[model samples]
Target: MAGKLSVLAVVALATAAVFPSSVSAQPPLPPGPVTMIVGWPAGGPSDAVARLVGAHMAKALNQPVMIDNRAGAGGNIGSDAAARARADGSTIMLATVASHGLNSALYTRLNHDPLKDFAPIGLITTSPSVLLVPRDSPLHSVRELIEKARAQPGKLNYGSGGVGSSQHLAGASFKKLAGVDIAHIPYKGTAPAMTDLMAGRVDLVLTTGAMSFIRSNKVRALAVAAPRRLPALPDVPTFDEAGLKGFHTDSWYGLVAPAGTPRPVLEQLNAALATALRDPELERQFSEQGSLPVKPMGVDEFWNFVRKQMPTAAEQVRISGAKAE
Candidate 1:
């Protein structure tokens, strides 16, 4: 028995020498390049935030971060994929309001539980939707838009990325608050919706990422859907200032890993995210785009934040009268 024990001890030492026990204790960085799934198309606000923040996060972690856009079903495709991915920290996702917050209440047949399926990494940024119109449109202000809509019910239409997007919610909220019968036009993505808006195929759009168009004068900002005007669009008036009070719909972006992802991996990812958000250039870019980076928070705090947002999102969906797919 002593000799058998000695042999077993020798084997254990050899195994330890070959593969250090510390390796198991300290998890290695994601097996290889990290893939971040964006639930929207490449040109939307969620995609933009993913690219910008992923670039910085890549530098911080010394690992390449790739963005995979699985845009469909009001951001459910990418979100579902992220939830079902291997929970090894290699595959994370840039979750948005449409996915984590509103989709639960919007989609009746959702495959994944918005809150249960994700381990929150951190909140990225948030931006208020802006009510915009084609540059040559006859409508000059929010009041004009409302009056025109009321005058010709269902004549004036608004475009949105999809049925339950932030843009959609904002447009629906506008219709409800203004008490008009404007038609809704839902597109595959915001870029296409914006394209139609520019071509005058759509009367207007309430969007979060039209800063470039607004800057170049392709679209006129009728009103910001916030309490105050954005610095990027200082001249533009808030919805309240434009005669529509209590109008607010802000979009948020955040990172999340699959629910079973190791807590250590989540910690590492959160740290890298915090480091990237600290970059002044990134902050400046976010501000210029009318999106504000959220303050850093620990994983638990972020999870709580997401939990709190779910109620507000459900209420928004109820107000918008958005139905499930």
Candidate 2:
């Protein structure tokens, strides 16, 4: 009995030494101001979404979250900056559809890889594009636009934010699916594209629903590139309903950190974002802008989404003949 008791005591001590309680204890997250990099100018869809989510993220983290707009080069300037930033949790990016997924396919010689340079935090929201034409223009619907383009091949011109932007891809997708010939006019940004579309300088523009012209009726919404009709514009038909079946394109926003960021920090940000997504006020605000709040997914899911989207976007870029220069 004495020998057995001694052996049991020895085993307990050995176990305790090998597995200290502190071993399981997690260190508290580092403290500092967190910066969200926006790859576009202020007041744009990505900027607005970043500001909104950043506000909630700041509150959740108990630290100020600042939005730094580093716009240029079709979102490459800001994205590249974020990609090269230190893996410390302080710097993250609000990556848009273009920077996170489409730019790889669009730019022939991109400086960084979206998948390799950043760790995805989570998906934030998705907003569909609205096809708009001048109110006084003869085009009344998607069918009308298609008919016009078919009738006058290579005559109808459409404007986009840039060569590889979501607007450009949406327009190109429409042309391919609808079998119409149209000229693409690349502008500096969506605002400028919308400006020309409203002025009747361009025949059409596929822009985000946030465009003032769409709400003010300066430009008429001929169709939306979504699976279903938006609540804000119930009367406007989706491209699928408007005779372009299987047509869908959305402008998505997500959070990402420089690769090699700590897993705990990523989890913390994802938790805060999940909480923010549940807030009713934020939901209402997002809905007003035609954005749908997406459920937060883990790093793997976000990466999976990127992988699935990049190839399709690349194919679209090839089909559209959209070049970086």
> What number of clashing residue pairs does each candidate have, in the order they appear?
0, 0
Tell me each candidate's TM-score.
Answer: 0.92, 0.86
Q: Candidate 1, 157: how far from true, in Å?
A: 0.9
Expressed as tens digits, the lDDT of each residue in 1-325 for candidate 2 is 9999999999999998787554234333468789899877776667788998999878888888999988778888888999999787789998878987678877778888898889878889999988889889998988888998999999999998776678888888788888989888987667677778879999998877464566777889888888989887888899888888888887888999998887777888888888888888888888887787687787789879977887777776787666675
- Runs off by more than 4 Å, candidate 2: 1-32
So what's the TM-score on candidate 2?
0.86
Per-candidate Cα RMSD to the true structure, in Å, reads 3.0, 4.3
Query: lDDT of each structure?
Result: 0.88, 0.82
lDDT of 1 at 173: 82
Q: Residue by residue across 186-256, what tens digits does model 1's lDDT show?
A: 88778889999999999999988789899998999889988888988999999899888999888988899
Worst 10 residues of 2 by lDDT: 20-29
Total clashing pairs in model 1: 0
Clashing pairs in 2: none
